[model samples]
Target: MTDTSIEPSADAPAQLSTLDRFLPVWIGAAMLIGIVLGKAIPDLDETLDAIKIDTVSLPIAIGLLAMMYPVLAKVKYTRIGESLDRRSLVMSLVLNWLIGPALMFALAWILLPDLPEYRTGLIIVGLARCIAMVLIWNDLACGSRELAAVLVAINSLFQIVAYSILGYFYLELLPEWLGLDSDGIDVTMWEIAKSVLIFLGIPLLAGFLTRTIGERAKGVEWYEERFLPRIGPVALYGLLFTIVILFALQGEQITEQPWDVARIAVPLLIYFALMWFGSYFAGLKMGFPYERNTSIAFTAAGNNFELAIAVSIGVFGVTSGQALAGVVGPLIEVPVLVALVYVSLWAKRRYYDTDGVRPRS
Candidate 1:
């Protein structure tokens, strides 16, 4: 589903279908629509391409910014210091950056050994950890919004450094070790840094300012109860719009060989499911309660695909396999995470303690 918070939108309808509950149908429809348009309007990318400055597409950049601003606006800054549940934070970091990346490295090599572009694209996706939308998934599962918010705050900054270093290491050096071709896939650390700065850094600052000023002026209650709800759906709607343009640009590439899209999606599906289960069980074994554990699970399982796609397009070309893979990310992620959302809900009731209390180790 869309990555908006579980907080009900100010203007939401009371009833939501299974399709409405998750974003797969909507996101998938967007993908198909983009693809169809791409096929129908073979020159669509060119038309969009005309409205660009330097390498960055103005429309795409704005679309990407719109997707993240709402999520950033809701960061509970006070919790940045107070929400340090040491056990939960450490586990999330390990699963997200360390184990998760290693798992992706293995999967990418095994699954996409030959296709370096697609393989590198998947690895880039792994390097960029979830910041914004996992908050949405975490909230939906009745997890700690504060913990989710704090982790996002931490990861948003961490990604600036970690993504570039890891991107270089995995996308560059890892291939050297495996003896795979490392030719045109040389997207340097700086390239990623630039994209992260524009895509993530701006939103983080804006979100922080929005929260700090809004709370100070309008009062915390109004900011949370009224302002947050109004902007809540922006990220979701932005995501759909970005997808249309992405698939439209990627149309020829996608239509020429549709199976490549499926191939790239394979590792992403495995990563999301495995990481979620791994984090969930790890939390239980470590004795964190259900709410805290779900926060850890979703944070580890979800990805910052907005950053991934932007970096891929900036570093790799818009029509490059890497960018295409980045676009395909949400197509797979929304559904997989939605299923896991249900799975987490089931586990919340059947497997986890409803009271969300566990003894310290």
Candidate 2:
């Protein structure tokens, strides 16, 4: 449960790994392929179209399941008890649920009010917090994995409930506070809940169950060492493919309304910068080690786009402007975070004297 070896490497490049390096490229390729397929083979579109149930989108579900399997496999549930830090847990909860969403709402309102379409997108981004990609960011930043795991669970729980309730209040009730009219927009709590449950709950449960069973049968060490690392890349690829498909489905919208992308991008960029520095300074003030501080910073900075996308689509319909905002998040998020990883490493060397907690080999 404790990290005692592998100090931070001072000489490593501020760049993505072999797998990470190519992931965005692959994602782009998948999106192009999906668009071509959607356009060329209308039957394929029909087949993809037919694979839906009620509010749940099947292709997204499958992609999420694939994405989560690797993440779940890395989770050491046994360490949950041993690794539990009450202070860290409380800090993460307060930040994600109370401060994170509140700040996001404030920023979105301040930055995105002029454009209603982008404003809805900002709301979706605010509602959906970091769950999955935070882990990758934490790892890159040399943050505490144990704390990341705990935060992921906490945020996921909050997202299911808060995303619905908060989203409703934000879109419906809070408009008056911000001096905006709410007569035309229809926001439903039921729709939000249903989408979170379908997209998040099912895949989360499946991934957890699969991991639990695998661990019980083969043991944790074996599951982590033998199975997870191998399948991790596959899951990542699946997620990218799913993203491409979603984008392709909305390609016409993106192509036609190109200005909308830049509109959402502005607030999202501001939010990311604010959260990154906010958490970083907060961690430094708290006197946490560099690694733990980096972990906290990135965990707070990242957004759970999968959950955001699903909730947006469910709440605003797949073709709505809000869903388009959700889609744009990942496109901006990936490259920025990869750059931040290197920045973190640079900061660690420049600021802290590394006598403890060496970087991983």
Candidate 3:
């Protein structure tokens, strides 16, 4: 078995060094193209609309599965047991489930209560952490890939349980606490579980299985070198395509409610800043090195929208305000995360000695 705790060498091409530099531009272009194509091409919209694959939920599931492989392959599974630091793990869990979500709820309440639709949207965005994109960013920031893999796996598992529990408490129980009635609310917990299972669980399982099989057959080095990089872009493309289709379907809503976009962006911006600094500063205080600190920060900062969207649609109905909020998460997340990667790299130079800690050139 490959030791998952071993960090990949900075020189390894297994990670996307070149693309990381220009990721923001690429993501922006992809979003623009998606929007333009979604608006201009009637047939394309109709085609995406016509094709439905609920049983397998292929696009999102496949995209997620594909995205995780590269990250998982770097796990150094052989050393994974040695890398289990309880302090780091507990801190991350408390921050993600407790601190992160609570902060998001408070921010959304303050910033968006006047706009119900956007308030709900902000909630969805706040609840979901970035499972796929953070790993990529962590790699770019020269963070501990092993820790990232473990966190991603753990987060994926917790998201299903925590999403349902926290979502209920926030959307329902908290409303009651605030003296609001949730009498006619039609949200169902089972639906949330189902969506998580289809979108997150299946894809995660597929990625794990694929990695396991690949490692067994080709060895960890071969799987990481030969397979993961080739498939990494596919995951991003898949995610992009799914988002385009989603936005295309809801183009009219976006067109009509221009302010809704701004509303969604606000809490997201706040959440991103909070998580980034919270993790970075916390890690620094905990005496972590730059590499591990960067990983912790980025991992905490990112939101996993695939799972978020899936759960939002499940809990709030496809056209519900919450689902719309989930849709807008990527709009802000992609660009912001890319920018942070650059910021993290810069931080590395200013704080850590450049002798051995420089990001891959």
Off by over 4 Å in 2: 1-8, 11-17, 27-50, 183-224, 355-361
The better-scoring model by lDDT among 1 and 2 is 1
Per-residue lDDT for 304-333 in model 3, tens only?
776666655655555667767776787887
Give candidate 1 regions above 4 Å deviation. 1-22, 358-361
Clashes of each: 1, 5, 16
Q: Per-residue lDDT tens digits of candidate 1, residues 38-122? A: 8898578778867777656777778767877886687677776666677777887888888988998889889987888888788
Cα-based TM-score, every candidate: 0.84, 0.81, 0.83
Q: Please give the lDDT score at residue 32 for candidate 1.
A: 86
Positional deviation of 13 in candidate 2, in angstroms? 5.5
* Candidate that would win on TM-score: 1
Off by over 4 Å in 3: 1-17, 41-50, 55-57, 180-229, 355-361
**lDDT per residue as tens, model 2, 41-111:** 54553455457887567887777666655655555566666555666667667667777777777776787
